[model samples]
Structures are given as C-alpha cells and as structure tokens.
Target: MSGTKPMGTDEHDAARTERLRKAMRCLEGGQFAQARVLIEPLCDDRRADVILAHALAGSGRSTRAARMLCRLAHDNPTARHPAQDMMTLLLRHSRLEEIEVTLRATLRQTPDDIRLYDQLGEFLLLHGRTDEAIEVLIEGCRRHPSALRTGNLLAVTQNETGEAQKAQALLRHLLSYHPQSAMTHANLAHILTVDNRMDEALHHHARALELRPDDPHIHLNHAMTLLKAGRHAQGWPEYEWRLRIPGRLKYPAERLLPTLRQDSDLSGQRILILSEAGLGDMLMYLRFVPALVRRGARVTLQVPREILPLAARIYGVERVIDPLRPVPAHDWHCPFGSLPRVLGQTSDIIGAPIPYLHADPHKVLVWEDYMPPRPGLRVGLVWGGASRPGVAQAQAIDRKRSMNLAQLAPLATVPGLYLINLQRGQHARQMIDIPEGMQLYDPMDDVRDMDDTAAIIMNLDLVVSVDTSIVHLAGALGRPVIMMDRYDNCWRWQSGRSDSQWYPGLRIVRQDRPGAWDGVVARVRDMLLPARPDNP
Candidate 1:
C-alpha cells in the first residue's frame, strides 16, 4: 500500500458511513441545523441530496430547498423520493404553474413515471381545469395500461366533465381487473347515479360498502345515490355519516347533547334542534319542527343569526337561539337533517304539506310598496348563489346550479314578465347588461334577511331560481316556483319529475345535460311565451 491511504480504504469508508448515520439521527430528531451542517459537505454524493434537501426544508429555507430538490430530481430521474419531495413543496406553496412545468419536464425525462401523471392530473382537476386533466390522465392510462389508480382517476375526471359514458367504460374495464378496489366501485356508482341508472348504481354502491365498510366518503355517496333514486327510507340513515366525514364539524357525540333516537318517546322531553348544513337545508327541514312539537316534545331551535328571526316564527318552537350565543340546556339534540330519519319518513310522506314557513304579515305589506306595480307578471330571478373560490364543494355547486346573467338573455325576449332581481352578493352586479325594453327591478339592496327575502317572494307571481336557499324559502312559503334545476340536482328534487313532493307548488325544469343552461332557459322562455297573458 502507498503512504497515502486510498479513497476506498476501510478507515475512510467507515468514517463516511458514521458521518451519514449521525446526520440521519440529527434529521430524525428534528435537529435540522445540525443535520444541514453535517450533510452540506456531502452534497456532491447523489444519496445525500435528498437528506440535505429535507434538512434545508426543515431549517425554514424551503424555497432554496425546493430548488435543490428539483435539481436533484431532474438529475436523478429514477429516484422517486426527490421528485415527490419537490412536488410536495411546490403544492404546499400553491405553485401550480411551477408544478405543471416541473412535472411535464420530468415526464419528458422519465415518461414511464405513472405517479407524476396522477399528481399532475389531480392538481389540474382540483383547480377546475378538467379538460386538461382528462388529457393528462388519458395519456397516463395509455402509458401505464395496468395502473388501476390512474384508470380510476381518469374515469372520475371523465364523469365530472359530463363524459359519463366514457367514464363508465373505463371503470368497467378497471373493475374487470381490480374488482377488489373500493374506490373503483365508488367511482362507477357515482357515474351510474348521474346517468339515472339507480338499480345498477345501488348494486355497485353496496359492493363498495362491502369492500370498505368504514369509508365515510363511500357511505356519503351511497346515501346520495339512494336519496336521488327516491329511496329515502334507506338513504337518511346512511346520510347521517356526513357528520363523521373529514372536514366537517367533528364534535364528540358525548360532548354535545344526546342524539334523539327514532323510537324514543318524547312526550315531555326537552329537545334541542341544532341547525345543521346550509341555509337551504335548514329551511327545507323546518317542516319537521312542527312534527316534533306534535309529538309533545318542547322544541328549542339553535339557528344562524340571519335565520333567527324567521326560525322564531315557527309555530311550535318554544325558543329560537342563535348558535353564536350561549346554548340553552336540553335533554336531547338532533340536527335539522336528522328529523326525517328520526321520523322514519319515506317518499310517500313527502306529500305531507307545504307553506311550513310563514312570512311576517307586516313585512309582506311593507315590501308591497317596493314592488314595480306593473300590470304584467312579476317573476323573481336568482341567477346565482354564494360560492367561494377554491372550495371544491362550493365550486361544484356553482358550476352545476348557476348560470351567467347574460345566459338569461333569451328570457328578455318574452314580453309581459317583469324580471325582479332576487339575486344577492356579487352576482347582482351581473344585471348591468339587462336588455333594452326588459322590465327588470332590483330590490336585492333592501332584502336584508330571510324574512325580507320571504316577504319579497310573497309579492312575486312566480319565482324562477337555481337550487339555492331562496328556492327553499319560496317553496316553504307555498309560492308557485319554477326551479331551474341542474342535471345533478339535490336529493329533495329527486329525478325525472316536473313536480316535487317536498314542494307541491314547485315545478322543476332541469337540464337534460350538464352545463346546458341554454336549453333550460329556452324552455323557461317557451313556457313563459305560451302562457303570457297577452299571447292567446
């Protein structure tokens, strides 16, 4: 041996291994600064790059660390860890454009990386770029023919974009190979539900539940499918799983009031009704309050402030308190949505009654002066509802149930109908381009609360609206409403029926296809045109 030791000598190799072991220990112990110091000298080693990047990220230099990881991933195409870390950092910062660029570049170098395609496609879909996501996933399926995950995601995106037939085919193909996958069955079930193939949807839903009995998302989907098929007897119990789903309120059952049981005798029990779900849901379920009262239970309603005044007007509610305020003591509690299940209500009982909610007589008279006092029919229009950007559920609802005010241009051609704008929030600004000679009134400014909204609805001859709280309010007041429903409407509306059992006075005009508001608006116009007092 020479006087100088070789680079691969036992002593040199042992020292290098010891150094790496200590660095890993420091990193595992959250000693990021120490780990970084130990690992920086070994940055030239390909194996040390990932550890160095993690250390740098842990030390709060995430941007610099992200750059390092991206370079590492680019240089090492076969190393999945570096690429995954880089994508994670990019996603945490919402650098979607950067992620797209980085993923596309990496895919060019390593076209066989199925995960990259899945990640890119999911990111695109989540950000509302459905068409682009579909393209990416389709390519991914072609490259990785046997990849079940990629195939499932592609089918889901396809269903979301109204390509249900394509999604159905893809899911069926996946099921043929991976029949044990719970997610695949769930995706197929959802597509079938959208296609109104309820029997087949239910079969798939049952199979999915059998595979993954504890999956809340699967249970929630099953509930919706059953409800959509007008099978409420089985649906309501499954629907209760919503409270247990992630991202929803997760208060412990013990910490909150005791849940009222279906078979419980409540002749003198003090029951609390917690207002759950959205404003529309509260309005829709308010009918059950009187039903509870009829059972001789003293009902106390906890509601949002906006609906406090209106909720207080319910005939048998002993006290109406805002949820923001201190809660009153009660023997048991039930969410508004649970009433149907507790009452064991089925579709047959949906025809019970209407006008469950009453407007303030005084306020109704006051709104009379605010009306345009025209001779023609006064129709209320709610083109949109509240939807914050970036929330998937809200975005999906807005896309399905809302339309641009300009899309309602066809309605302007119909004469003798004064279009009263009941649209609130930012969507009211859309009324700027009302067609010339169209009699339109904007009273959204004075419509302060649900009471005011109810009062205004009472003045209109017909309320034409999307599936929003206003429609529920109008229906609850027994007003004749023409609901401009989406293809995938809420469970209450059901399917293939012009009339609703929940609101007997309401007539639904739904889209034959998703995003086809033009047809819906045209139908409304034709219906209005033929029925115009001056027409025939």
Candidate 2:
C-alpha cells in the first residue's frame, strides 16, 4: 500500500479543495446557507482563511471576519486589500469599535499606510464622529497629501463638520493633482452644489460625466442641477432613468407602446395616459390628456383609485381606469411625466390655461356659507400632505424645505390678511405657535377629497404654499398662488422663473440660494405689502 501511494493521492486534500470551490460557487449564486455547509470542514485551514472570513461576513458575524482579516493583514502586509474591504463592511454595519481597533492595529504595523488612515477616517465620519474623522484624515493627508482617498474623506468630513471652504480647498487640490477620478469630481460637484455655487457645480458635474458617462448617480445629480438651473431640456431624460433605481416604481415595458407607432389615422386610436410616480405627478400631467383626445384618439386616464374620481372630473374624461386592474386594450401608453418630453416642450413654447377644472356647484355652495368672510385678503395655506411614502421622503416639508413657515409669522403680522389653515395631518403640530386670529378657518374636518380641496380653494382669494400638491391643485383651479421654494427645488418648478409656465396664475418665490427661506419670505412679503387704495 505504501509503495502504491501516488505523488498526491490524499483523499481529504482533494475533497477539501473541491468543497471549497463548491462553497465559492454557492456564494456566487447567493445561496449563503449552502455555502456555509461546504465551508464547515475547512474552518482551520490556513489556505481557506480568507474564504472563511467572507462566509462569516455573509452570515452577519462581520466582526469575526474583520479580526481574521486583521491578523492576515499583519502577517502579510502586502495583502492589506482584504483588511480595507473588511473595514468598509464594518463601517456599513456601524461597528465603529471593531473598525477603530482594527485600524489602530494596522496603523501600528504600517504607520505610513495612507489607505488604512483613509478607511479609519471614513468609518469615523459614517459613525457621526465627524470631528475625529476630520482630524485623523487631515493628519494623514498632511503626511501623504497626494493620496486621493485620504484627501477625499478629509474634504468630505470637513464639509460635513461645517468647514465647506476648507473642504472645497482639499477637493480642488485633489482634482488638480489627480483629475482623472470621476469620484473626486462628483464629490467636488456635490460640495459646490451645497455651497450654492451653481456654475461651479455644473462645471464639476459635467467633468465627472465626461469621465464616466454611464454613472447613474452622477447623471441624477447633474440632472438635478440642470433642473435647478432652469435647464429642463436635458433634465427629464436623465430623471426618467430613476425608474431603474432599486425600490422605485417600474412601469411596464409596454408603457412606451412602440407597436402603436404606426401612422394609421387616430380616428379609432386608443391612447392610455398611464400614471407612474406620485399623486402630484399624476395631477400635473393630466393636463395633456385633453390634447390627446383632441387628436381624435379614444383616451383613458389610468391612475391610482384614490385619485380616480377627482382626476376624471378635473381632466373632463369619461373613463378613468385603476392601474391595479387588468389593463384594457390601448394602442399607445406613456407615463404621466413623459408628456412634456414626448411633446418636445421648451420654456417659450409652453402654454398654461387656468381654471381648467370646475368644482360641483353643490359643493361650492356648501363651502360658500361654511367659509367666513375675510376682512381683507384671504390667503389659503396647506402645511402638509397625506403621509404617503412619496410625501414622507420626497414632497413633505422638512426643516430644510419649510423655512417659509417660520417666515410666514411676519406675513401674519400684516393687517388685512386673513390666513386660512387648509393644512392637515400630524405635521400641523408645527403650527401650534402661530398667533391667534391669523387663521380664518380649518376645513380639514371636512376636507377629505379633491372636491373638498377645490371648494375650499375656490372660496379663498389666494393660496400660498411650499411645493406641495395643493399648489398644483390651486393653480389648476385658476386660483392665484405664490409658491415658496428651497434651493434644491423640484424639477416641475423649473429654474429661476418667478412665474410657473404650467400654471398661469402661479407665482414662484424661490430662494436666491438654497435653504434661504428668509430671503424667499422677504420677497413674498414685499410683493404683498399692505395694499394701498391706488394699488388695490
């Protein structure tokens, strides 16, 4: 048997290698549990330590993987990449203590390692230890000033800690040193955007795009900047790509309706106005359905059932289909927001007609008596929207978008102005401090649907809001509205236009810079100063 033994005939050795390879394949296929089964026999194998570390990491025992990575890194200093990878994972898990411990140990072994310092500093920032992250990164950057990772984090953390100018300097320095990294350009562009330097931000974003055209995040950021700069010709197309983002709503591939691109006469054509995104988006785009009908096509408005009754009424359509139902036959379908793009709209070519909707006479009569007469100007206000997922994250007024609310305190002080609370929801809790008598009514008790909203708006002299759907509703109903906006405003507002092209009676009050509610409020105040008899 000894003489018959081959050069490498150890059964266990062959089996171990095969099992490890199978575990790797299982991991690659996303079967983590199956991978663990194959990995159990090789726990003590030095050759399989990294694989074991990765498996443990997948199992959520990342601290153990991190320790294994640290030991491996100490023994094999040239293989420090694994250590950096583990640090990144730990940072995501918010395991700050383990990160700090591993980083310190690695730093002791290779004090001059810039990558180690960078990882440590980034983790500190992720954990909200911005001051310490800044200190560590700055020291490392001073030692190895040209290291992009160290310099980038130092700059970002500095900006996070309220030292934007210093952050800008570091980023610009890195850009000057290494102009090829799209990441550096993207970071610099974001900082510039936050600093209210639109021109510089645009330039940096364009540069980043030049380096990496297909990067979706950079594309989204650039599109936002363009929309903010009032350059919508390029923004919407980039914005459309947002559907591809994880957890974002996906319209069917058939929504584009290429098969219906035939030039056959529209005398019998079927058109579908598919709702995709938010209630506001649905309402905003419903204006185009009439145009489709005018082309002799049979048009159907597909939307969430909650808004169907109101949309059908305002849009003047006989058919409003719920999207949750099986789609009926349609020759063509497109997203609600795609109307402008499909129609090839530009600023000068856009047309807006007000009061496109009519409230029921009965509802109007009900509100007419329910609403008290105002002594002077009647200004309707809506401080919140439904707490739908979209509103909570995208449209809801947070501390940043809501500086106008605080500024309205001064508006209340202006005599001959009856401020009515069309506001609703838990967000109304923010208005508890508003002085009494400024409020004319709180119709929220009866305001449940668009009919109620329209009745209340029709009775008011004017509406004032901060980028909520009520602004759109008021504008659609031909009520004069002054829309307050933040620096990073929504795309629908367009950039820099004092008046909305989408709503003829709507005037915009945008921050001269982002987050400057004081200036926006002051502008609105100046426009509505105590009316003289001559002006009135």
lDDT of each: 0.80, 0.69
Count of clashes in candidate 1:
0
Residue 90 displacement (Å), model 2: 9.5
Q: Which pairs of residues collide in candidate 2?
A: 487-514
Instruction: For model 2, give the RMSD to the true fold.
Output: 6.5
Q: What are the per-model C-alpha RMSD values against the true structure?
A: 5.9, 6.5
Candidate 2 lDDT over residue span 95-160, tens digit each: 556557656665665677676787777666555576787778878987898888788878866664
Clash counts for the predictions, in order? 0, 1
- Residue 502: error of model 2 in Å? 2.0
lDDT of 1 by residue, 1-536 (tens): 56965677888778877888888888777676798899888877866877787667666665666566657756765556365664565566555665566566656655777877887787787778888988899999998776788999898777777788999999999888898989999999988988889999999999999999999999999999999888887898888888787756434465443334445556877888887878998988887787677767899998888778888988778999987777677777788877777676433234236888888999999998988777878899988988867688787778778888888888878777778889988777877776555657888787778889889989989999998998888998999999899887777777799998788788899999988999999888887774546655
lDDT of 2 at 47: 55
What shift in Å separates residue 315 of candidate 2 from its native position after superposition? 4.7
- With a 3 Å backbone cut-off (N, CA, C), the pairs that clash in candidate 1 are none
Off by over 4 Å in 2: 1-66, 72-170, 186-206, 216-222, 225-265, 314-318, 345-352, 383-399, 404-407, 432-440, 533-536
- Candidate with top TM-score is 1
Candidate 1 — which residues are off by over 4 angstroms?
1-88, 246-264, 345-352, 530-536
